[model samples]
Target: MSSSTPADAGSKPAGPLSGILVVSIDQAVAGPLCAMRLADAGARVIKIEAEDGDRARDYDKAMGSTSAAFGWLNRGKESVVLNLKDPGDLALVKAMLARADVFVQNLAPGASDRLGLGAAQLTKEFPRLVVVDIMGYGRETSYASKRAYDMLVQSESGICAVTGTPEVPSKVGISIADIGTGTNAYAAVLEALFERERTGRGQALEVAMFDCMAEWMSLPLLHFDYMGVETARFGLSHASVYPYRPYHCADGDIVVSIQSTAEWVRFCTTVLRSPEFAKDPRFIDNWARVQNRDALDEAIHAVFTPHSCAEMIERLEAGQIAWARVSTLHDLSVHPALRRIPVEMPGGEMAEMPRPAGRIVASGAKVPPLGADTARIRAEFAGAAPAAAKQA
Candidate 1:
């Protein structure tokens, strides 16, 4: 393992994405995330925005003024506010696309085509330009034009159906749908780029949040299809295991899972101090224990009531039982393995944000301010830019 920290490591002379130039007509999470990942790996990203800017800028009041999401994902890119409806700005965007290795967009449904930026148009004009489109739903579907948000997509894709307690299905607290789409788009774009090198032709990539969420919901979807029954939510409890849920240890609750019969036997003997309980016919196997869950829970609760959380954890650890504290969001921030990067915002203030995981990089650069490079880009590409292509 390389002992070099990404923070202390100097910029590499050769980056994995060094020669790439990406143009993005994007706003919000999915598009920004894709562009940011490219930029982080040393691609020169031009984030084309509407005059009003990405709505994510005003998402929250935390961190003084800048939204945390924007700060996290918009770094290391040149932002340019453009009016796509205006011929001049549209022409400028096309000029960038002419020279770009990649062009990505997540505009409102049909808006990209209206502005002549859809995959069909770009693929025709720039044969070798990788075009990636991010949408709420796939274009082939009837509901393609509906306004789609992360929470709505999660609900629509049936992710909420299997998550949370049985009484109330809840959307994931984070923007999981958007992130999923972004991640899928990123991987798809990389794959297309690789294939492009071989074929000498770039391909178009499309990813929708609904489609991504549906793919993620496959496990539950398959289970329901096979069994012809919906899985009931157990509120953090295992559906087929007893004494495999959170239990109060004197004051606070701790989660533990006793999966195998041998682990259950050890828990009964070492933790519960009732070795005979393991051999009780009613609680012998997982199925039987699950059937008698009420009684099993009561027995385990009684054993836990007398012990402190630390004592219970120590005993559980010694018994080789899997256990963990019910961690809150705050606990996640201070987790032992958590990595943070200091973000320097436009206002010259720095804040530590969680670093992106699984990012392979050989170079680094800072983000440009909104429209910081608009003049330079316009001047550089003005003469070479094709006239505004008529919309179909």
Candidate 2:
């Protein structure tokens, strides 16, 4: 594992966003994750937290003394503690925003407005600043003020209805709502930055968690709205696609997907060793197979249940079928394709974790401790601070 201190003002990694400055009043998963992406792209991210720090910091001490969530989402950024209710501290934030290229926050709905750090207010004051407001629901809706945690938003968006087994609706095991919202926020920030380059003016943007989950639920929503098809929860199996789910083998399970006629033919002939099955009238096409899924499952189980995972895998490879083992956490920990990067935790210990897709993060980037850069930042912006409560 590699290691480095939290980046100082004078030093930043070389990337497309090398010269960009990001000031974020962010907490928890969504906001921090968005800021981290900017930091990964070499933007200098200054994370302004409350005096007690981000609540995620106390979620768990899974990574030494730092919470796993905080450690995972806060590398390569400076941490500054501030009480927004304090006039002096609020002035400091305003000073930082004056020079920042982007500002991101995921405070409770209307909290930013109370603090005078709302997107509308910020963009008006800083014409060149791209401002992003991450919210649980769109401000235009009645649910705007409703509290929305990851599971709440997932349930509200009907993601739970199409997940889990047939008997039980379940929220995703991971925080998909928060993750998707943060990712969308990051993309919006990037778009705003590009637009700023073209127009020499930045824009205010809103990214709602409910909106993100709704977009992800498009397939199920469309089916129900247009075709009167309520997507069923199939557990490990797909609701609409036949033979696109896992089958129990001698030792474990392996998922197989036959998406086209050619793949179906190859699967029947090579993997199942039954070319005749490919021409069966009840399973000739995808729609037909879906209708006769019970018989299809029985037939597939008859073959797979008698074979070992390795044997089926070899046959699957021979047939060029898309397949995967139902991998556990242990399996993924040792996965050959999993790429890891070294990160320096808040306590100065080096740890390795999976790398982000499509981004080259600096290996030695460090996660800042609570208020690690507070004093320095306070001093740097002291002289520039406007009159207390004037703009705030």
Candidate 3:
């Protein structure tokens, strides 16, 4: 990887996000994740950052001094650090926006509006541009003005309420709130793009982190609404489904989900070595297993006790049952499906990071280096020269 070439170096061919120009002013996860998805699909995304750059750029240099978050989400895009407060810088960004097909931003509440870069303003100026506004909360909610972080939204959305051990609630370790909002925003932008193709006009999208995660919490809310009781944190167990959780094996833990009665019959016959057990009155069906939960759990434990994790996996495979290994973070780093790419940094350092999971068949696709296209962009946008970079 060289400074003038692939910032995060990879040999993969161009992807589907190719050709489309996406201009984004973003910090942290949500907006970046969305843009990254577009980039993965072969979009020519330009990430316009503050002069200091996205805070995520410095969020822990885990991958040999390169921020893991940045290395992950920022690949396949050009990074242009500009001070939006400066008139020249603002003009430069607006110039880019004027030619952009999609504009995304995740600034503080009312921040874009105050700067006259709100969706309304942008839509008026660029009627064909799809403007996506990513916020932490719904624009008119009670917590609209309140600050929201990833974990905070997860907690407020009742995800924490139903996660972790019963004694204490815990937020999901990952940024579920931010990621979910970004995913929804991406889908909305795609839908808006499709609509624009027919109407020849763009649409404004408002995606809130709290709302996205809250929508995921709907099932638990519905349970409480109809049953007058909230779902409890049972750790690895399904809140409403019995025998659908991890069980102890001799050397390690294995998770198994017997979702259907037919599969449960196979499990009893092959894994449990007790075909008649499936016909027992106490464990005849899903509801019976739930009603005789204690007995059912004990029976499952007995069947699983003598086997090791690998042995249990084999049994589950033989029985054609769905199973999982309780893997650790360390284990995932070397997971067979993991893909890594090298990114060129300022100090002549190259950092290898995971590639975004958007595999498309194309050629000559790559991530641009920081300011690599600055002079060309200036010349092209200032109307002093022809486009210095290839269009699409």
User: Residue by residue across 191-240, what tens digits does model 3's lDDT show?
Assistant: 99888879878878999998898789888898789978678888888877
Stretches of candidate 1 exceeding 4 Å from the true structure: 1-14, 238-244, 258-269, 273-292, 360-367, 385-392
- Per-candidate total of colliding backbone pairs: 1, 0, 9
State each model's CA lDDT, in order.
Answer: 0.79, 0.88, 0.77
Runs in model 3 deviating more than 4 A are: 1-17, 339-355, 358-372, 383-392
True lDDT of residue 344, candidate 2: 88
Residue-by-residue lDDT tens digits, candidate 1, 1-392: 00111221244333477668788988889999998887777667788877667888778746555677787788877777788889988878877777787888898899888877889988988888889989999899998999898999999998787778989888887999999899888888888878977987887888999999999887768868997656667778876567789998897998989889899999998988899999999899997997798899899899898889998998998899999887889999889978777666655567777778876433234444667667766676676635224211
Q: Candidate 1: lDDT of 233?
A: 70
217-264: candidate 2 lDDT, tens digit per residue: 998899899999899899988877778999999999999999999999
Error of 1 at 301 (Å): 2.1
Structural RMSD, model 1: 5.1
Model 2 off-target regions past 4 Å?
A: 1-7, 385-392
User: Where does candidate 2 have its weakest 10-residue lDDT segment?
Assistant: 1-10
Q: What is the C-alpha RMSD of each candidate to the true structure, in Å?
A: 5.1, 3.7, 4.8
